[model samples]
Target: MVPVTRITIQDVAREAGVSVATVDRVLNRRAGVRSDTVKRVEAAADKLAYQPDRLAARLARARDYRFCFVLPTGTNTFMQSLHSEVEATAARLTAERIRISVRLVDVFDGLALAEELERLGEDFDGVAVVALDHPAVREAINGLADAGVKVVTLVSDAPGSKRVHYVGIDNTAAGRTAAMLLGRFVGPRKGKVGLIAGSLALRDHVERQFGFEQVMAREFPQLEVLPVREGRDDFEKVETVTAALLAETPDLVGIYNVGAGNRGIVAALEATERSGEVIFLAHDLTPFTRKHLVRGTIDAIVNQDPGHQARSAARVLLSACEDTPIVPDQERIRIDVFLRDNIP
Candidate 1:
């Protein structure tokens, strides 16, 4: 187990190569500090896992804070797990004087998400979302921020927006990790690799695909990546597209699903008599994926812990609402990789 250390202003100053006074100025949200210096201070604070000593500092004063979480409504196990975490964490957060509510929208409807964000108004102090990257959605997020709403993007991000923070893993790095595993597993076998996703409209999916392609081109140039199949996170669509791809590319030796709907992919894979011939990689660990892993059908699973994400998002939003600085290390979510031998 990692030991927890309480970070102080001095620690942050030393980490940032600055003085305690400079750290104080930045922490106090004071003026006259250069933007670069402020960033360095903030980065150091995060790296040091600095949280205000609530027991000793007067900043611990708390009041009722209203917050909302916007998630997609779907049969996807990952989304369900995320929602459950939000619900489960709510009671604990309520004890801290933070009231939480969850709102579900159409799985891929950006317009619906925009309307939800716009409708929130001043009724809620902060909002966290499993974002869908769209112009209207970005506009809605910015509009809320303009109205003094603390916005935090969860799982996915709305780039070019003034959202207070993004609470998720670096998708590009996750993709690169997936590619590295896939390349090594495929060995010297030169064959086409199938890529499937919910939608490129989602920044996470696009970034993952981009990273996968970049690594593949650089390290596994011999392996060809087939045209991406957009399954829209629907089991029927994913299954159909995956089956069709298998039919078209007899030389397909690997597949990477960057989004949900792993069940569909698994069904299609099971229909074939290839055994371990095709290597499968996907995001998220659920009952369905776990079963595939135990059977040795799916070669590897790349997952994000929704429970940690939900809790982190809440902490960040609460801090934003209370004018408290966040511990960057605490808010950083990790990507978990699993193999058949390491299913736990």
Candidate 2:
């Protein structure tokens, strides 16, 4: 076994160019420190991979924590899965004195999400959000952090915000993986390709699209990508868009739905009798996606485990509450690729 070396306050102080006293004050939640100095100390602690002993902290003082999970209210399979995982996590953590409440919001509305974040008030000690990359939402996160509430971004992220951590897979790598799978499955890559996404405004969707395009340009030069359609995770909207795309591109070889709404794509393909003709790739392996995968309607489903993400996010928040250290790699959510032959 590798010998472990505990990170000390002096190390954080050195990294932040501050005194050990300043680091101790920041870690202990003591006052008499500038805001910038506090950020520096926290950043240094994060960079140094500092982990406090949670067991000792618990023994010293036990406290009940109120954590709020802000989720998008929808029938979308992935959202439903995330919701279930959050509920289950709440139950699992209850004996530890963690109270979790799942709050639903209109996922597509950034203004509404911002308003909801602001309205949370002092009801919860910490908040975990499936964030939209919007300025208003970022402002809300900053406001929450300012109020001494621990915040974590779940699944999606507000990249430049003050959120403590982002619990999700590397979406760009996921997109690239999808592109490689699509390019190889479609025997001759010399046909028009199409891409569908909820919105390019979301960081995950944008990163996935960027990674997909990069791989397609580098490895599959013969395939041409068409302008992406904003499916908005709506079945009817995606169905309409897919139908239009099919009508327009006679030789479309493959299509990757980078966001939600695979149900709509399946519906359109089934109706058009083109399910077997074109290679389809999507994210999330839900019951709908599973059935379609088994039927060979979707060639691959790039997946992230909702339960794993929920558990990791909760653990991270709980650790933060006690000023404990977290293992970075342990919190990483996996990217799973599923096919008809390998449906797990």
Candidate 3:
């Protein structure tokens, strides 16, 4: 086991090049410390991740640590489950002197997401966001970190940001796995494969598609991956897209839904009476998808547990506040592949 290094006021004093008395005064908000010295002490404390003694001779203490979750607003079952997980996690952690609030935003809009993060500011000690791969979002995340608010990218991530941690599976690997599954399922057949996504702006979806195409180009040269369609995770939109694809491309033998709107895909296939004709694969293992998997509508599902992500994000925020060491293995989210025979 790795050792846990406990941070103390002496360590902060040494890092700040000051005496223990100065560190104490800075922490307690005493009037004797100079402004520059106080800033140095605070910076050292933050760098060392110093956790103050909140329960020192106090009967009850206010919840001074606040965390926020910024989730995408949509009807995707997986996103809905993630939102519920955060709410349940918040309810369970009420007595721990921590407050968690969730905000819904349009994750596909880079400007809107950037504005939301900019508004968060110092109101939240930590923020967990399902970020888009946008320059504006990255800048906003950096601004939050500069203001002493820890940021964690959840589910989807923003590249080149100052996020303290990421709480999700390896999306690239998941996408490559999806391609392998589809290629093998359509073994030795030469046909086109269709792809559907909520939005290419999402880092997770982009990475997934990249990995899928990489694998297909390298290993499965026999199959051709067609241009992807953005359905925005809406059932009706996905249905229309799928129906159009079926009508336009008769050689489509496989499909991989990298995002949500599973019901829409099913509706399109069933309406066209092509239910068992194509190799259909998707992400997320919910009640609706599980049923389809059992009924042979969906060949396989590459899934990530939303419960694991929600708990890990919350625990990571709490650890940042408490200056505790994190177990990387415990916090690692697994990429699960589920089939009809292995639904459990």
Candidate 4:
């Protein structure tokens, strides 16, 4: 975990090898501060990567930037990790005069999510939402932008909106990668491939499905893609759906779960005594997925760094609030492909 980061005068003073008073005087442009001391203090602050907002804290009304993370309410292990990372990032940034809060919403429900986004309006300086690509949700995000609030889409993107930035992996690329891996893994086997997701309403899932089909149609025509099923990333729902899929299609040779609930799929496979018979590819390398990968129950896992996404979302929102230039490379989230040999 990242340590609590507070760039106060004391930190600058220590870095500058000067007393607190000297550093404070230098920062405040007060008299009695020597030129060399001012130079040292400025250098130390720069080296510490301190934000100008720290100086703004001296005013009668200090600037406290508040950011909101609108995440989904689910038991998905990946979502759980993302929620924890958000909280950790919030704690690490609290000392820097940043206020971050996470709000749980049914991201699968377009209207409900839109209502929540609309309710958040101008209350927060910036908002990072796990946005669904729905007209209502996009309208709500634009509403926030029109109200002078910065909006960023997190995890899943709501395109064609007034959002200033997006923080997550390239879903289309991830999907294509999954398709190639699964296709090659089940090489020469002519059978049906089942696609599962939390919700098709999510732009990420839809893009993944699209990309997967594109590759399958071009390179892996031997495999037939079944109509996708939505499990809401629920274990029970996924288990029931998987059982149905497996029962209905005895020739189910491959499955690509673009969302969570890998455990349910694995359990269903185990119960049906088809654990090692079918090729399974999943998203997010959580403990369960990691174990399954190592045990050869799961062929591959596509993952995005939850911690990096959380930190990037915060940094992007802060930059937007300050009108500062954002470093694209610093905020770009990488998609990781983990197999059994490279479980780490």
Candidate 5:
């Protein structure tokens, strides 16, 4: 039989330079103790090699640990689909003794997202955010990591930060695939193409744009891609901008929507009776886009399963809590391509 080890709360109290009552408060998570004092007690316990029994700890604690989900609030079909998936996943997780909180913010406002991220520091054990590539948001994620919270990014990622991992499709490759499809669809044509983007402030949009432009410039030099028109993911803005581009460039034969606002694009094309005139390729297989694909309005769609994204993101947080290794094959998701014939 192996030898058993013994340690006492009094020993930890002495090592931490605090009284036994303070140690008890820290261990039991009692009220009225400052955070600094709690940190000191935890450090002392670590130094003196105090290990509490796992079953006893669970029995003593009543509050479930929390994980947060932050994303944009929008009426767009894609965002709505993502929100529904996350809510379903959150409900399932709650039954397993975990608490999940969902927060929605406007996609156009980086300041609001940063503020919400900062406020989550004390309330959650882990966080998963649809991050923006901005200094203020980066700082907020770093602060959460510093305070022992696990951070993960979903959909669009914020690289070079303290994010533990990312859960989404490879966006660059998706863009390249879009270019290949459009280049092939518009065979032997010599006309300019128009690109509609959600927002350049997002890293994913920027990367997709880069991949699309590189492919067009190298292999399809006959096709000139106009400067990206910022849609801000708004229907009115997308329609107005696309109409302006159509008027300015009579030879525009194709359009690639790298972000949201497909509804507006469809409406604008219908109004001009050019619904089937331009070769349209877009992202995401939301219900709206699915119908459009069936009707021949959209030629192809590059999709990342939002349901898979939510489930994988939740599993990452649970793995962090359990101190387990994540399986790359299981967590690394795929980007799917949907054509009219292959629509599911």
Candidate 6:
């Protein structure tokens, strides 16, 4: 048996310069205390080396805790997959006394996402956000963090902020992997390859484009990668852009899609009667993309499993609440490559 230190609420109250009731409110996270007072109480507790018995507090409080998830409302297959996976995990977490509320906002509209993040301040204990690299969104995340809300960035991340943690694969590495696959698939073909990205405004897309260009320039000098065309993650837009590229560059022997737009790419290739003739590489393993992979519409797919992303995000949030250490390796997501030979 280990020795324990006995500390009482009155002791904490005296040290914190507040009443016993204020200490109670801070410990239990009850209403009526100002944020500054709460911070003082927390600081006092830490100074005194105070640690609350979490199990006892949980049993006594028995208050339902809520987690908010904010994501983009887009038809892009990757976004849809992320939304579905989060919903599934939220449902499972409900059984463990956690309530998850999901909110969807227009991805293209940065103001809408920022507004949504701001609105979550009063309603949730923690938040999981798929963020864009915008100042308004970053400010909103900082506001939430200042309010003692644990923020976890999913898929896309906001760096240099008070966000508790992030749960996603290294997107730059994923991009490099995609480049490697495409370069190998091209196999010494000396021609300009077209690149399609969702939106350069997004950090993930920008990072991917950077990595792709870096690898292509370093390893395959003969393979000139064309300027990236923004598809906006829309099927019709992707098709239109791809068609224009095909028309302009007749020797476009290879293509790489660093974002969701596989459907449009497939349609464009088929309509142009060059589906199998062009070596195409894309991201994500949606049902349609999988089928296209087998049929040779897409030569390869760089997949990041949505299931893994959701689980990792949840585990990180839970660990934050419990004040526990995260297993980095377990949470380190993988960049999976899918080809015709390995469809699963």
lDDT of each residue in 228-247, candidate 1, tens digit only: 99998888899999999888
Clashes of each: 0, 2, 0, 0, 0, 0
Give stretches of model 3 more than 4 Å off.
Answer: 1-62
Candidate 4 or 6, higher lDDT?
Answer: 4
User: Is candidate 1 or 3 superior in TM-score?
Assistant: 3
Give a tens-digit lDDT track for model 2, residues 1-344.
99989987678889999998888899889999999999999999999998665555554565678899999876567988999999999998877678899999976789999999998858878899988999999999999988888899988889899989999999999999999999999976589899999877678889999999999999999999998899888778899999999999999999999989898999999999999899999999999899999999999999999999999989998877777779998999989999899886
lDDT (Cα, 0-100) at 214 in candidate 2? 96
Model 6 TM-score on a 0 to 1 scale: 0.83
Best by lDDT: 3
Question: Native-vs-model 2 lDDT?
Answer: 0.89
TM-score, prediction 4: 0.84
Per residue, candidate 4 scores C-alpha lDDT tens digits across 156-214 of 99889999999999999999999999999999989999999998888999999999999
lDDT tens digits, residues 121-178, model 3?
A: 8699999999999999999999999998989999998769999899999999999999
Give the lDDT of residue 234 in candidate 2.
78
What TM-score do all the candidates reach, one by one?
Answer: 0.83, 0.84, 0.84, 0.84, 0.82, 0.83
Q: Model 5 — which ten-residue stretch has the worst lDDT?
A: 52-61
Compared with the true structure, model 1 gives a TM-score of: 0.83
Model 2: per-residue Cα lDDT at residue 136: 94
| lDDT of candidate model 1 versus the reference | 0.89
C-alpha lDDT values of all predictions: 0.89, 0.89, 0.91, 0.90, 0.87, 0.85
lDDT of 3 at 317: 78
Runs off by more than 4 Å, candidate 4: 1-61
- In candidate 3, how many Å is residue 158 off? 0.8
